[model samples]
Target chain A: MRDQPTGDQLLATARDLLREDVLPTLSGSQRHNALMIANAMSIAMRQLQSGDEPERRELAALGKILPLPESHGLALQQALTEANRALCRLIREGRADSGQTRDQVRALLLETTRQRVAISNPKYLG
Target chain B: MMEETLRQALAAFIAKETGAAEARISEAKLLTGGAVQENWKVQVDITGGAYAGVLDAVIRTDSASGGVAVSHNRAEEYALLKAAFAAGVTVPEPLWLCADKAVIGRPFFVMLCIAGTAAGHLLVKDARYGGDRVQLAERLGMELARIHSIRPPRPDLAFLEWYEEAPALHSVGRFRRYLDSHAIPHPALEWGLRWLERNAPPRGDIVLSHRDFRTGNYMVDENGLTGILDWEFAGWSDPLEDIGWFCAKCWRFGAKGREAGGIGEREDFYRGYEKISGRRLDRQLVHYWEVMAHAAWAIIAIQQAERHVSGEETSLMLALTGHIAPELEYEILTMTEPV
Candidate 1:
């Protein structure tokens, strides 16, 4: 088991300190840099909190769209990349132009992008 | 901004180029915010020549680190600036181009500097600069119309590629090709691309487009616009492409309520364009290009982040740029969602 004050906790604490303390002391590009660092830390914390659950969910979602051998052994990240890449081909081929497929693809893309935004910048989701 | 040897070479080159007894660089300060280009603000004093006075200029050259494949080199950018200047576009006057790399270790050009700030975030909020927002928007529109006046078939700009596909479709194809080569898939971006393909504006009057036209790309003083800048991405494309790029929500810099580049209403900008081009803008067509603009920005963001991800450059800014893609993707998704 991981110890207390894990990676996310550390990042959260650091980001709070940077935003509250360091940012006020900085100006110009230094201020911009501090804000960007704080933003990166927040993103890291969000990703850590969410863990690999988003990727796992993404993989399962991709499995529904792309045809593949049942239970074909592949790692989570690799399988996700492969499946999403295939979907890219399908979309480009106009297979998702207008129909159930188009609607499903749109929904999937929206959901997946929302998931990414959830980690990268949740405020954008508004 | 310049080493001793480079400064000496530049002085010699200026002296020779202007038929001056001597040219001395009083100051050379590297300006910020051009990721691909190095822009050095240079102040020069010339003696015994037609240009025999203190002059302010910008020395522009490619960063040795290289840039996107689609952008033109320093020489091409210089030529584009000349064309824009000739077209009466409010651009920094292109003074001279030096193709000899041995002089500065890279091809560089000199242009008369315009006084203003070009930071989008500042321009949007700070009334201290950029003058009256409505007039600025109108002027920007007029400037864009003037830029679009420079049509193809010119011998000098023969370097620009002539494309058969509608500009929108061409852009979508380019993005797809990039995604195909990218290490990972971007289904959100692809979704935007598909919508663009379905609704691309038809191939129409081809004109020179300031492909990177946006709030940050131009400069404005307390009174008004000083000049349009950044022509590295200049190319032949449908005129609406530039308009879309200019008015895209992504370019608004958080001043979403204002529209027309976060400065004025859309009609004011369009009216300015109409005053110059004597043509009306099709709102529907402009919307399509706005969607394309988001997709284009997302691609550029991904490429920048890749520069950091692949270790070609270690930069916090580049890594942060990667994070912006999701926001852009969200914008794309919202814009392309069926009514």
Candidate 2:
């Protein structure tokens, strides 16, 4: 809404320029560096494209697992941090090892990790 | 030039260490591809003495920064390379170690550099090495078996802690403790760790494990593997740990089709290992350790990313490594979660 080229669009253009236009001219470590920059840009673009959907979904999943107040006046990132810390405690204490809890925890962890992988490296999903 | 000064120092050190009358170093240049260590390629020509030949060698020393927590120091790495060389593991011949800080302002060691490419992507992608992938994979397995031939209870390897329980359990516990200390709370990684802990096989005869034995760590040429490099992470553990680590999907460098280090099939590697060690690889046990491999790599990726994130050593490579964590975590879930 603000401009013609959005954040993700600009990032995608830059990444393509680095990979297709600039990368072929370089070799050895310089090429490797350029490729890494392109990779980082690509991940950033993916995150932007996905928006806050992954974060919101993760929070929803965490709310069911952790004893947290829904609709609390906490930021999504803060809520995630608190929920993950509590989940870690439960896992470490062996409370989430067996029965229905383990299945829920596993499913949530898998879903959350899938979201991360989708942003970071979608090719790895297969 | 700085190169001339380093050359003179290196020649003088070589003369003193080998009791040579005179030694001259030439063509000294830094080699790439060791995030934690610096390797300088040098040609050393010695006059009449016990060491009296022109040699293409590598001067390996610690980098200014970005050393892994689990790796050995330069002196220790020199000893490890020496032990591997003595065991005929196709490693570079360790020549001399200079522990004196006065020599190069840090500890360093020189070894005879061999010919080959150690780039994982190149080896996995190139069609030139396609014909010999099976043989190369088997030879690597045999070489690993030879490395495992060196068992524990040695006075030299006394620094390595022995595990009375299963070494797999020890590895799981160590990684869990590392994660707990960080307190970052990676549920997928935790799930993998829990699986590893529960499925750890009984401790077999503890042998020297090349903890980082994988595709990227070895050198291969048109003919075959020239040298098995990087001995800093070598330690005593279950032999199968190396096998799992070698075949781990994460280390395949995008050549996931060829499971054995992305070079050849697993059966050939296992057959080669069994031929030497007389012990068959347990497929199920190896699978558990493979899960552990992903978890361990994820932890390392996190640590590498921290080096950049914490501003301790700002490196693009380290920063990129952090992006690999989610992928590794995803792989851990696929392997450990009920499917």
Candidate 3:
């Protein structure tokens, strides 16, 4: 059997197809939909590659704002860890309000993570 | 418990007033885009109200969660809308205000629905109405200038407090406090704030300021701008703030080449404003506020994104708002750094 295409290969192929065959052909509402879909895909790929770094950095930053009892570095790490755990619990319990709060916590974490990653890993593309 | 009960109460109240007894109230979905308050599309058929036609009115109220300092109370906002409408600004007519908590669990107002489009990207992209865009942009500028020209002797509207004082310092402190409350660290934003503080613009002749004058905030029809919505942030300040805000890059809706509401050149808007106001354009002041406008928008975007992430509200729009921070930051950096 022929070797299966790797995830990267598949993503590249899909992107190329979208840019060449799909985007050029679209018009009106179809063009809008295609553009939105392409944008979503690009975001998804970027998130997959560099999303975690932002999360870590954001957690660290949060620690500075709302100081925990632990040391700075540990607090940063723990606060983020606790935030994730809290989010997991809220999701599992199906608490709608809590879910919303968790989203804010997650956003802060992710944003901080992204900024930190950008500073640390200059070559990282998103 | 409250949301469902509130909806029922609201329907009952509206039904009683409108005299449409058979009106069936169904599905009250909370609409997005109002940052400081909540807006919902309440679909109901007339059963027994004073007016017999089917009613589709937007119910607006203060949000339970995070809200900004400058947000007017529902009654106040309604009053403002009525006053603005009276002044010949195209606005949805304010219908009713309910302060009774038993009705909607908070103070809220209802307004007649105006049919028009407000999406900036869609407006810019649609080739059918491309020719009208520049003319519409100019009209919008002129109309805004008209709004600023309104000097109030009316008893209903409260006189703006900071009219006599230097507004730049006040704004600097106000924005600084807002940033401090959020406690998000941004050295660049802080630097911009400091720059504004150090080089505060001299207080010019004061007039009305539509604090958030931008493309998306306005309503447009086939002819041109029909209405300018979202006066929650409206107040008295330097008129240039409004002009600068309208011309700011963030409001350009992804069309970089066209500057005036991303529809035409800045001169078109400037010419229109000059025609209406009888004042020569201050290019330097407009440039300054344009930088500040982006900074303000960036902060707002951050706040909006925060709501999505913090779980107060979750929507794709909010998520996208967060993504715009980088672009806004870049704008501030470029504007502030000397050539």
- Candidate maximizing lDDT: 1
Ranking by TM-score: 1, 2, 3
Clashes of each: 0, 0, 26
Which of candidates 1 and 3 is the stronger one according to lDDT? 1
Cα lDDT tens digits, model 3, A11-110, are 5678778978999998976786676555555555555556466656655555543443454555454556554443333333333223554445444534
Off by over 4 Å in 1: A69-72, B33-35
TM-score of 2: 0.95
For each candidate in turn, the TM-score is: 0.96, 0.95, 0.68
Q: Chain B of candidate 3 versus the native chain B: what TM-score? A: 0.82
- Candidate 2 Cα outliers beyond 4 Å, as residue runs: A1-4, A69-71, B33-35
Q: CA lDDT of each candidate? A: 0.88, 0.84, 0.69
What DockQ class does candidate 3 belong to?
incorrect
lDDT of prediction 2 = 0.84
What lDDT score goes with residue B255 in model 2? Answer: 88
| lDDT order of candidates, top first | 1, 2, 3
Q: Which 10 successive residues of model 3 chain A have the least lDDT summed?
A: A88-97
